[model samples]
Each structure stands twice: as structure tokens, then as C-alpha cells.
Target: MPSSTPLHTPFCDLLGCRYPILQAGMGGVARAELVVAVAGAGGFGCLGMVRESPDLIRQQVDQVRALTSNPFAVNLIPSATDPDLFRAELDECVRLRIPVLMFFWDVVADAVARAKDAGCLVIHQVGSVEHAKRAEAAGADMIIAQGVEAGGHVHGMVSSLVLLPQVVDAVSIPVVGSGGFASGRSLVAALALGAHGIHCGTAFLATKESFAHDVHKQKILSATECDTIHTDAFAINWPPHSNVRVLKTEVTESIESQPYGHLPDKIPRRVVAEEQGRPIYWMSTDSPLKSMTGDLEKLAMYAGQVTGQITQIEDVQTVIHRIVAEAEATLQQLSNRS
Candidate 1:
């Protein structure tokens, strides 16, 4: 990939953002700095709102607002509870009059109406064409096609390579492709397949502003696609069918040897140690450096299949700018010969 696409060629009218390169909203990893940095760099940044209390969401929103007057989105976890859990946060969005609201997981009708009532743009992330249609009917202004290659929770067997084009045709609204996008060539491929923009998580996890633990970042940098594995190890406490794309480690190996549907009586003690700020050979819930630990060899370094493409750590702004430039150049090269 080369730097050739105009810096602002792909603008997201749905969210009124300048760049089509979105910093994927990652829970526990997405922080104010990461959001602001990407937004400041001309791309839209999303703050992951899963597990956040209403007050925390409001505070994050206010913090992002103060940092940049630019339009940023709040990635809402619609699957967590009834819409009631997010009612207060929804009210705040209405109060602040935020421009973009991207919902992941379950999309409830009332949630859409509330955001719409506030004049907020609604974007929904889905894994299948069925979900895409549902989101659109629920009043989504856009749909994010999250393929199986995605890092955290993979929703469907549909991969980005196949799912993007399918959802694009299925929906009248904008279709954004996600799942393992780490380079401009990937973005170019996505656009050619009918995607309007790109949604990325793992790429942003390696950036300077990411709140991930230092060890986590290192693991990603060191890993290849084969080094990563998808497992339900975290699902014991997290979401069912909960899959995480993590660098293969002792924990994953141990978990994989167990019978299906079996859960550990207790989370590995390493999880607590990691959370308490101690280093461990395996990632546990307790790994405080979960976001950017740079120690993927022993941590739950969540990533996509594209983890193979990432080899270095870069500043958030540089990463954003480079992706856009490379995408443009690749597209232009194709256009020139054609």
C-alpha cells in the first residue's frame, strides 16, 4: 500500500466525519486519548460503552466533547440489558445532541427511536444480512458488517471478505466493512466490494493512545495470524458464544483441551494477578495492562486475522493518516491502469 488516496476522499456523511477510517470502539481499550487522537486526525473515533455505567458514559462523552469539537460517536452496547440500562445515557446524548450513535450487539426498536428523536445518527454493527435488514428497519442510518475475522466477539460465520459485499447489496443504507482490517489495501478491497468506510479494532489497539496494557501491544506486534486463536475462555464470565481472537498462550491451550461447554470452576488466578498490575504468563480478567501491555506472548492479546500484518507500534495519528493515504494510492493505481 502506498500513500496516494486524497486525505479526505472518503468522508462519512452518515456521521459527518471527515475521514472514512474509523478507530474501532473497543471496550476497556478505547479511551478518551484514543478517541480524540483519531478524531483529531480527521477520522471518527468511537468510545466503547459496554460495561460502563451511565455516569461513566456521560463523563466520557463530556471529556471527548471538551477535547475536540469534532463529531465523534459513542458505541453503545445494546445487548447488555434492557434499553432501560442505557436510558440515562441516551438522555445525555440527546442533551449533548451528539451526532453519531453506533450500536453493537442487540438493536432494540425503542433505542433507535430515542436516538432518532435526539437527531442522532444511528449506525448498527451486524454479522449477517439478516441483521443488516433488521437494523435498517429499526431505523439505522448505516450498518457495520463485522466479519468473523473480528477480534472480540464474532457474531456469524460470514467473513468480511464475503459478508461485506452481501450486506452491501442487502441494505439501502451505508455498509461499512470491519474484521481484520489493518492496511490500506484492505480498505481498498473493502470499498471495491461496496463498503462505504472501514471499521477497525486490532489496528488501533497497537497505537500509542490505546489504553491497552504495554504487554498486550507487544504480543500483537510479535504475533502472526497463526499465533492467534479464537476461544470461549473468556465467555465463562463474558458473553456466550463469546469468542476472543487472542495470541495463543498456555491459558488458551489449557482451555482448548477441556470438553465443550465445560467452564473452569474459577477464573485462572493469573487473571486476578494481571488485573492487580502483576505480569502473568496468561491473560486473566485481572490483567490491568489489558489495553496496551505489549506482552502478547503471555497476555490475551485480542486481534483479528490481520494480526499477521501488524509488525510495529506507531502513533495513532500516523496510523490513521497512513491507512487513508495507502488506500488512496492503491485505488488510484488500479484506476490508472484500468
Candidate 2:
């Protein structure tokens, strides 16, 4: 049965979802099951396809298709991807008839044209008004205005409260606000700020269906807004000198004590024995996905300033329904007051 919830927005209609909530394509974390769960719950779910093989992308997409007929998105970070591999992934997405394609870090005109030609909606994630305008001119279907408060690799320096309105004013296309959003109040605030929807990352990391390790989820639940620190410490694993937001772990503390460009030359690795007594080496910068078993506490625990709002771990459906229901009630109250 379709939800009778009064929380309706143009973004939801455009994406064919019941709510205007999009799961952030956190690399290595947004897997097939999480996407299926979010999409099935009436919110858009996106697969994080960065650094993934074409075959794995196909398998994940196929799994999502088998679970839900609803629309979902696939995110690709062009700057982090090999040109040929990105082309292959794009081709697979087109052949599989995926509905949405999202790009971050850098815009690829050819990929945008190809996805559009294949009848797919293209969303570009931007950190500034200029990038948002560029995305609009590049034939993007929509834009996600990501602020510096976002977890993981944040590309912009402005906060969501300041950037969303600017991007909305600068772009003719629909704009979604990301960074520091975890509640219905924040969703309503995004709409008030002229955003058609909200893009959330840290909040979803605490969800039961997320691929993040249990320890990481617990850390998210226990963390306060001040528990997160944004720095270029973990950039050595991916793009050098890039800024990232992660939990305040001992590793981060050590990095903070060092001068810029004077950090360790070697990537920290932890060895853990598998079920069969086979040892596996894990990188400290890798996301704490369930497939990984190691010193998760010492690795990067990417979370946003909204971590304070995420007090518990719930299923995707519950999370979506609660946010929508709260927003509807809040809107109703505001309307009555006026």
C-alpha cells in the first residue's frame, strides 16, 4: 500500500520515491542490501560504485533489481576511477537499465551525455554554487549541494546552512542539500532553504542494514557533534591533500599533532586472523564494512556533525518513516500557526 503521508515534495515525485530522502553513496559502505532496503522503504538508495569492478557493479545492480522495482541510484567518483573502468561501469549501468546515475569529485561530460542518451537521470554532486551552475549547463537532471559538514571526502568549505541556498539560487535544476542532516527538522529546513530534498550519509551509517561494522555503528550512536574532526590526514590512502571528516580516533589525534605535509610516509596496516586462521591485512583508511574484520576501532570512522542526532540503530524503513512522519507533523503545526 502506498503511504498516505502528507510529506510530498517535487524531488520525491522526480525520483519516484515516497519521500525526498537520498542515501549518500558512501564508498565501500553503500552496498546492494542497503540500497534495496532504502529504496524499498520509499527513499532513494544509491550504490557506491567507486573502485568497484564492472562485474561487481553488474551483480549489485542485479541484486537490487531482484529485490525492488523502485528507482535507485549509482554513484561514481570520476576522479578516483580509472577512465576505462568508469566507461565499463557506465556501460553496464546503461545496459542494466538503471534509472539514476550520479557523479562526484569531477564532472564527466561524456558520461553525462551517454547516461542521458540511455534515458537515465543524471545527478551531479557539487560543493559550490559555481559547480552547481556547471552541472546544470552540463545537462544534469539534478544537483546535490554538499557542504563541508559532510562526512568522508568533503570537497567544499562552506556549511550546508550556507551553501544550500546559494546552490539553489545558482542552478535551474533541482538541488538537494547534503551534510549534517539526520532528522525530520533538518529535512524540513532543507525545503525551507529551497532544496527539493535532503541527502544524508552519517545518519544512514547508523542504520541496521548498513554494511558498516557493528563497532563503527556503535561509535556513531555514541558520538557527539564534537566527536568528528575534518582534516587531510587520511588523504594518503586515496587523493593526496584532500579533506575528510572522521571520528576522533587515536590515529586522527596523532595526525593532528603533526605539522602539515609531515605525516607518516607509510599507510598503517592491521593484521587479523580469519576463521580459518588466515591472516588478513587491513588498511586504516578503509571503511569498516561487514566484510572486513580487523582493528576497526583504529580505522577511519567517517561521520558527520549530525552524529549527535543518531542515538540508535534502526532499520531503513523505520528511519525513513519516522523522518517523514515527523516532518509532516511539523509542517502541519507550522501551517496551523500561520
Clashing pairs in 2: none
Candidate 2 matches the true fold with a TM-score of 0.92
lDDT of 2: 0.83
Root-mean-square deviation per candidate: 4.1, 2.7
Assess the local accuracy of residue 247 in candidate 2 as a C-alpha lDDT between 0 and 100.
86
- Candidate 2 lDDT over 166-201, as tens digits, reads 999988889999998878888999999999899999
Candidate 1: Cα lDDT at 198: 89
